[model samples]
Target: MKNITYYLKATFSWFVLPFIVLVLASAAPVKNDVSEKEVIRLGFIPLTDCAPIIMAKELGLFEKYGVNVEVTKEASWANVRDKILTGELDGAHCLFSMPFSVYTGIGGKAGSEMKVAMILNNNGQAITLSKDFCGKVGFKQTGKVASVVAAKLKADKEVTFAMTFPGGTHDVWLRYWLAAANVSQKTAKIITIPPPQMVANMKVGNMDGYCVGEPWNGVAVKQGIGFTEISTQDIWKHHPEKALVVNKKFSETRREDLKNVMKAVLEACKWLDNRANRKRAAEIIGKLPYVNAPADVIEARLMGDYNLGCDQGIEIYRDNYMLFHRNGETNLPRKSHAIWFMAQYMRFDYLKEAPDYNAIADKLILQDLYKEVATSMKIKIPEDDMKPFVIDLDKAKFDPNAPADYLKQVNSINQ
Candidate 1:
């Protein structure tokens, strides 16, 4: 019996113990292996969609994933751009079109670069028409703009509009809406204003209409200063709005850290997409230092509840409000979108000549990095990235393969 017991103990120690150790190792959380205790400084502008980055910090998602993130609130996109270029910021919740716009010279020096690591969210911006055009142009009324603007022109009103930046998403959306409405770009003076200041500028009668991201547009409507002529989703459903843009140095040197940070934000994006968590997100982001807006106002649009002012009533966008992660679809930054934005520059005369579209996209969007992060998280990537896409307002088909032909098909102001 002693001999048999000794034999059994020896076999168990050699085989079963090793098996248990291997099983335990396999079940443990895989370390992402980023260097210890390095704080990743990120930036953001005060907008509702800026939630993912801010929430990553609030929910300890960043820390959970073994990263430290400091999300600074920036004043304007231009300031965001300058800090990014200077490396004062490692990354930011940026405009999806910003790196493209900046690289192509609407607001940046030619040949300078900022890498779009991943997209943050989609479908939350809007073009808000001031109280002056309240009765003239109602919600989703893209057709009435021309006639109303024509009347304004004939009356010597010097029709003007505002966008958040020169070649950002707001500018392109505002331009697309203008062209689609047959309200020629030459007809109105389109100017740039910071997002938070948009309502105040319009309140003093500074502009007739403006295009900007949510919370501010929500603020405008809430204050009776403006009404949403069209939500950007009305312009293009699930259109890319903001991104996780990083400086070139960060992308090249701290690739693993960047991926971990992307993972953290992606987790936060998924959490925000849960629907039940949105009001909690709104309340957190509405605090004085973040968006600094009323939590109720922020929560309304955050939940797709738009109480459009100027007595235009309310618009409830259930599925298409502001998507963070639709099963990891929103995080992939497409080169095709980069190309389309550059082409829009051609259409609106922001570019005098056609840019090397593919080359420019290759320079800006960081798809390979995004794939690495999404794949590790077991998120399936969408395959329709390079395929043709159509906007909600027009029948124009944007073929990524033939951007030039699509350019010609869309009647350009320059043409």
Candidate 2:
């Protein structure tokens, strides 16, 4: 009787244990354990615009807000995407267009996505052309070549242009520049290269041009491998750049913690806008683990001075430099911007047809959450949703209220 009882009890224990373990693994936690057990890991690529995340961590902003944040440096945007999706990172300093691209199967598994918590910074990125084209295209701010050099370059050799990711802001900016310059998409090759590797790739004669954020473009000019063909701001003034994108699961399970994180980052954003602290900000990110460049190289560009290189002289941006907070308008994740990005995907034919713009924006941009954080912090939210805005280089306008009209305009452009 004792042996039978023992055998039955052992079988029940084995079967029940597995079920209990599985339930615990899949179930959500009842109590918030952010400060006690969980440390939110934030990842960033080594670019000048990653300053907000690094500053928030360095200036004790995250700690002050009652959340623990570990800022990790990532090699590429792809790594950032993988880590965020795998739960290795709670959030990241990501491209504004990445979440949209990821949701539509350009950058991630189709229908799977990271959420845009808020905008990080705006208008610091630029398109750099290799030394090969320095003489022909010297800082074309409008980026309108009329195929003067692009066609000739393509005709001479297999001209290649690089961007950081597909369907991302860099890719779009590069594509926009090409289209605006009348370079047929078929005539030139557009490839993906990681941001940091851009200058080196150009150094080794890997690609002819690339669109990337600072201080890589700064590094390229500093290294004498490339020149600033066109800054992204010139392409579209105050265009959206990096974002504070949170993992979907993190957003659901750790709402309060995420808000606190945004509050801290908001403080850092305001700090960055002061401009007086920019040198120190540059010093922080230029450290080995952050941007890993000379503080002077990063500082000059961060302060709105672009040594455009190629004897084109410096292009000083007083109002349109790398802006973390531009009188409170830079941080809001504008729905129209989302619509424009999706339209760009269609414009470049990355998407054969138009995506559901409103639906995707609603899913990705955390509008209500951002507003809550902004209101609590005494920051006024900007009312720029679904508004019509025109880009700098071209007259082609984008009105998010009527996306079809915008699509038709972009569709008419020479691809």
Q: Which candidate is the best by lDDT?
A: 2
Point out where model 2 deviates above 4 Å.
1-37, 139-146, 149-151, 411-415
Candidate 2 residues 136-222, lDDT tens each?
Answer: 765454435435545566456788889999988999998887887666787778899989899888999888888899999999898
- In model 2, where is the ten-residue run with the lowest total lDDT? 141-150
Local distance difference test scores for all models = 0.86, 0.87
TM-score to native of every candidate shown = 0.89, 0.89
Over the full model, what C-alpha lDDT does candidate 1 score relative to the true structure? 0.86
* Per-residue alpha-carbon lDDT of candidate 1 for residues 358-405, written as tens digits (9 for 90 to 100): 998987888998998899999989998889998878868999889889
User: In candidate 1, what residue range of length 10 has the lowest lDDT sum?
Assistant: 142-151
RMSD of each: 5.3, 11.1
Tell how far residue 58 is off in model 2, in angstroms: 0.4
